[model samples]
Target chain A: MCELMALSANVPTDIRFSFSGLCPRGGVTGPHRDGFGICFYEHGGLREFKDYLPSCQSAIAEFLKSYAIRSKTILSHIRQANVGGVSLENTHPFQRELWGKVWTFAHNGQMPIEQVPQPSYYQPVGTTDSEKIFCWILSELRSAFNADVCISQVSAYLHSLCNRLNALGINNILLSDGDAIFAFCSTKLHWVARKAPFGEAQLRDCDLSIDFASVNSDDHVSVVIATEPLTKNEQWLAMKSGEGRMFVNGESSWHDFGPEIIHKKSEPTKIAS
Target chain B: MCELMALSANVPTDIRFSFSGLCPRGGVTGPHRDGFGICFYEHGGLREFKDYLPSCQSAIAEFLKSYAIRSKTILSHIRQANVGGVSLENTHPFQRELWGKVWTFAHNGQMPIEQVPQPSYYQPVGTTDSEKIFCWILSELRSAFNADVCISQVSAYLHSLCNRLNALGINNILLSDGDAIFAFCSTKLHWVARKAPFGEAQLRDCDLSIDFASVNSDDHVSVVIATEPLTKNEQWLAMKSGEGRMFVNGESSWHDFGPEIIHKKSEPTKIAS
Candidate 1:
């Protein structure tokens, strides 16, 4: 299994605080040490950095920790190498250009190799089942939607596709196209939104803490989603199994359980300090 | 106008020496300070780094200078924007995947925006004429070939496409797909090959010199191409106007001029120390 994390904000926001909480899991605090990757979407452009070294030991990751690159949408992953070899090409957060926008996808769990469908337009450059599934989703989206179709119109359709993959195995995923973050939880995923009257939050993986009041203004709002909660003081809303949600401008705008599967909504899990 | 550099080698080679010679031109020695980017091909995978800051001032470029990443094929560009804004999306060495192989392109000259053809499949994410031309070429190639077609078999076709763009304006280009480096010279481009018995070479823009004999093995062979001669002691072969060439495994494998124009080949320019 792997770990996935994403951020969406009303304004450009630095990701260092949340990222610091997750980086330790790649090798020091957890066993997901195969590789690491992150994609930042800024001004309709994407910056991607990937390394085959463990995140805790990678120089690239170290530089990113110190570099204050502000972005509104971001997606990151740490791999454990279940379906592919440890390689630069097998790193998570694979990206492709669709309808003039850059689309990035990262997976957290395994899907049966035999059950994955063949892609027609987009092709996988790596041997990972994750990349193949990403390509398949893009290929299908290209066939079903035109360039003029709004991305929001395809949310339910995307949920339907994610539902099919969830049936095979664990299908936790994070996807984005510069505008919003689309999350699908088959096994595990949690999210926290911070706005006015923010308080201090302590890292769960490390001994670092950040006071949100000092860094954020009253109007600033941001939502962070991860495979596991990164902070102990914040109340992270855990998504129920087989659920899809779209986060836009620091808020959840749309959500749906696949038409085929009716899942009872679960209560939010609060991590006590 | 911008600066272009590329390398084709028989084995994986570190590009710091050549890159060091080109870095100064981005801001310190010349005026191409808009942005910089480089792409390295290693083990059938690609690593790309791009920054909006000038090469001389960018922390990312500084890290790359010392990182010592080795690869068999490399393409780099430092830009002086003409038709596009200085942003991450407008950075050179743009990349896209075709036929399950990552294709990268970097251009050093300008083309008339109105003359660029609209692409059908691949689309440009940036507003640069260079990116539009790249997408157009890829769209055309997708139509003319299939996944089964060997990349070498399509080199001649690629040259033809480049020739069309050259007619629109100055179009010096460097393109690679991990197998080889394809160069199209509309005006200025030079190259030199080094092998056994390699001698010392001094940089033209920096106060640094390297004795290749001390660093490289007897079997090492490398070809370096740039918009201008990068070394002060080497004999650089300048490509004729409207000529297309392919450098593979440290040697020029094929070359041709457009069928529409013919001219006498120019003599190699020798630079004295």
Candidate 2:
């Protein structure tokens, strides 16, 4: 499988320490050596870099080690290659523009690719099922509303889309539009929040630790979500098999993905050979 | 050159529409067809996929058209291979674990491979300077904290390390440890935020437009950052050269990378090629 990492904080913070422990799994301390990428939001836009190289050996990854790009919200990934070929075009953290804002995305599961109705305004660039899914959703949103939909309406639209995605199978995913973070879980997902009573954390894959108290003030609150627990001593809350949650400014905005209906009655559809 | 996309919203929103426009540039609409990868954060962890084919024609990107893996904070990237060989092992969006959190990263620029210091706790699995930089940074954090430093201290320590990295050549980067997003500007970086008075935006590279009023709420604040402006008629802020900034929950926290110091005053100090 693949691994994911994200940060949503009330204040901007650096991720170098945490990344130090997680990157080794990609063909080093572990086995997720397919590819990787990361995204950071700044001044209202997203800045990102991606590569088809293993995180353990990528020059970009090394630069990130010391680069220290900081954002209030961040998303990152390391690939293990279960589906697509390993090429630069297949790297994680894919991006697109809609409604004037840039949207960034990455995924960690394999889905049976299915042919779907193409959207009038959006189309896929790659053959990955993940990008196709994102495009379809955006098209749906554009068609559903004009340039005046309310926030509640937008949320409802997304809620319906999440339901549709879960129906597709193995729909664990993360998305952001530089305002909030939305996390939907079809399988494995976990999260933790660090606030006033912050403590030290230890890495599970590597010999490393950090004391959050030293970097955060009393007003700072931070939350983290990942595919696997990155530390040995921290309590990570695993999402139920089918649960979609939203985090805004380091707080959880719980949105039930609702009951999952397995499509055992329908024949599995395939897209790519 | 590669293209990057991200979303940080108050709710779960699919970037498929925006990404659809960006994907074409991968090879179909533009030129960055080397490879593609994307990661989505669901619940507390991440799910990701990568392909070693051009995003323009890759089945993986095609599948993403309909997949709606949503997150409040998302990061996505498309590659154009500036360094390392074009194999799956060299794709972007690398992931690792540290202090109990998964850290994800990706890069867009090339770095001199010989400038990096050899790492002890983390090491590169690929031959790219990106991965090497990632390992070196992680190792430094591990060494500085020794698995028992406070998180605040860890952040402070990272700030110092980031200062060192900013001194390196052209270090435009994004980083996250699952708490906050960190962004650094070296050469090219631009951003824009969409809020209350949101309006229509058109893609600079494609014939796509989205009226923000239809998809966003007044309460919904978003920020978009990129190496280049993605849209026309929007106020895109150019990051000051050689400066690093951080964003937390759609807000920016500016930090000076400190005074610039020349890496090599002469030739003898430079590592032999």
Relative to the true structure, candidate 1 reaches a TM of: 0.93
Tell me the tens digit of each residue's lDDT in model 2 across B1-273. Answer: 466665555565576766676678788767788777676554455555566578788666776765555556566667887667654445656555454344556665555677767766544545666666677777787677644443333554555565566555445566665445556565567777778877998887678888888977778776666767788789988866555665545556445554543333122133221
Q: Scored by CA lDDT, what does every candidate get?
A: 0.86, 0.66
Error of 2 at B101 (Å): 34
lDDT of 2: 0.66
Per prediction, the TM-score for chain B is 0.93, 0.84
Q: State the displacement of the C-alpha of residue B208, model 1, in Å, after optimal TM-score superposition.
A: 1.7
The alpha-carbon lDDT assigned to residue B240 of candidate 2 equals: 69
Identify the candidate with maximal lDDT. Answer: 1
lDDT of 1 by residue, B1-273 (tens): 899999999989999999999999999998999989998888557878888889999998899988988888999999999989998889989888899988899997665576788888998888999998889888898899988765566779989888877656677889887899999888889999999889999999999899999989999999999999999999899988778999898888999976443322242122121
Tell me model 1's lDDT, rounded to 2 decimals: 0.86
Best by TM-score: 1
Which 10-residue window in model 2 chain A sums to the lowest lDDT? Answer: A264-273
